[model samples]
Target: MRLSICAVAATLFTSTIAAPTSKFDSLANTSEESESEIVRRDGGDGKYFHEPGGDNTLGHYDKRYFHGVVSDEERRDTQKHMVRAYLDFFRKNDLDTWIAHGTLLGWWWNGQRLPWDFDLDTQVSGATLHHLGEAYNQTNHSYTSDDEQVKRTYLLDVNPWIWQRERGDGMNIIDARWIDVRNGLFIDITGLSETHPDSQPGIWSCKNYHRYRTDELYPMRETMFEGVIAKVPYSYDKILTDEYKESALVNTQFNGHEWNPNAKIWEKTEETLRQEEEERKKKEEEEKKKTVEQAQMA
Candidate 1:
């Protein structure tokens, strides 16, 4: 049940774009192709340049992932299912995963999925990634949906460049992913390894140039996230504060979206979706008009 990314992307490009209530919203707010030299390279940053939200990948630093429009409700539901699916898969195989970065932030906030998050983040030991790359790369693990009628397929795709211990992996530093085979939404899994044998004993770094001391992350704390058992860094509070600053832990209204205590969901205070729709329509109209003019000249 394993398939190449190109095969999946080509198929999805022809499929109906997901609705506004679906589980994917291409991160429209990111500054695509920033001046960061770490990203302006020959092969670009991410390996798979997906068509918008057609894939679960972030398409980092490029305007790569730009399709699919899912609502808040659909987004949360999908997040839950996706995380649960990964939990089940990892437990069965004895692969350890812990919530990191934004996923950890979500756990700190409410032990639930962040409404603003479009993807999930976790980390595994370097050995775990190597085991996956060897044994399960691109292998499909299928599970029945929550309804128990239809089936869902997941792929554990590992990157070949996981051995590059240097800090300049660009977007490729993401050593592996657990992808939802249906629509390509995936959770980014990074490998945390020692700096080098000769270097300091506790030095650690990720592909994204994120360096950390070993104690900052060792001894993963098992906890519940989105109703499923999960793991987080030992120093989750310190990690969250260090990465996101103090406001992220306390601020409820940073993004255009706000966390509603009554509904227990993050809701946008403004018509951001409506505005984006108008922008999309305008872009389409402009393209159509250009096509009409070209036809007259031809």
Candidate 2:
């Protein structure tokens, strides 16, 4: 009797979220209230359903909610929403979080989302995870944006497999996620815990098998991400260089892109890059033909 009632409720819930003509209409037409239906459609919390054992990978989410391929604008909105919602929650609860990985790299160049990046990363302490588990796990956060006049729902879901410290499976590395319930956009959160492996006495490790020094992450620096103030590693320079490379910090042209200081973003039209490549190839071909002709005449 209870299952039937829940099923009927879920059906009704999904009906209400049908995408509207508005620009801000959710790319994925459902929210957390209808999550049970989503789970039922797929055996697990869906993310990367194509990859074997992807259901187990922490932070790699499936975009099954999207009816078709996601648009760039939708990707941009999803990223902004993910960060804005996350920062709001942390600020409200007095929880400390630091931007890490690609998200931090993006902040270094400009206070904008990296055009090609969708996955976001953040970190907190082990104690913080437990605190969240006890008080806020499986919690749904609803936020209202006056500008867009849209209410968005987010979910904080933690992985119970984190208790097993062995770090054997690649599938279960993500400690938790702050998920955009409507679109499946999420910020992957990992808890750094103190570990005493044979190599060192005081080493901080995460379930993902990453080890760091105790002092490395401490004294988090205040910085802005996606236009909002947030925390970053104290030794950002060192961390960024280690993860990416020294040239990555200085290179303006990457992936056929150039920085536009006025816009404060990477901007290069596909046609422009294509033309440049073609011109270069044409010049190379001319030089090669001239060299061969000269050699044969000699």
Predicted structure with the largest TM-score when compared to the true one? 1
Q: Give candidate 1 regions above 4 Å deviation.
A: 1-75, 145-150, 169-171, 270-298
lDDT of 2 at 253: 77
Error of 2 at 283 (Å): 32
Q: Candidate 2 on 144-171: residue-level lDDT in tens?
A: 7647766788888875544434354455
- How high is the CA lDDT of each candidate model? 0.64, 0.64
What TM-scores do the predictions have?
A: 0.69, 0.68
Which stretches in model 2 have alpha-carbon errors above 4 Å?
1-60, 63-66, 146-148, 197-199, 272-298
What's model 2's overall lDDT? 0.64
C-alpha RMSD for every candidate: 14.1, 17.2
TM-score of model 1 relative to the true fold? 0.69
**What overall lDDT, based on C-alpha atoms, would model 1 receive against the true structure?**
0.64
Error of 1 at 161 (Å): 1.0
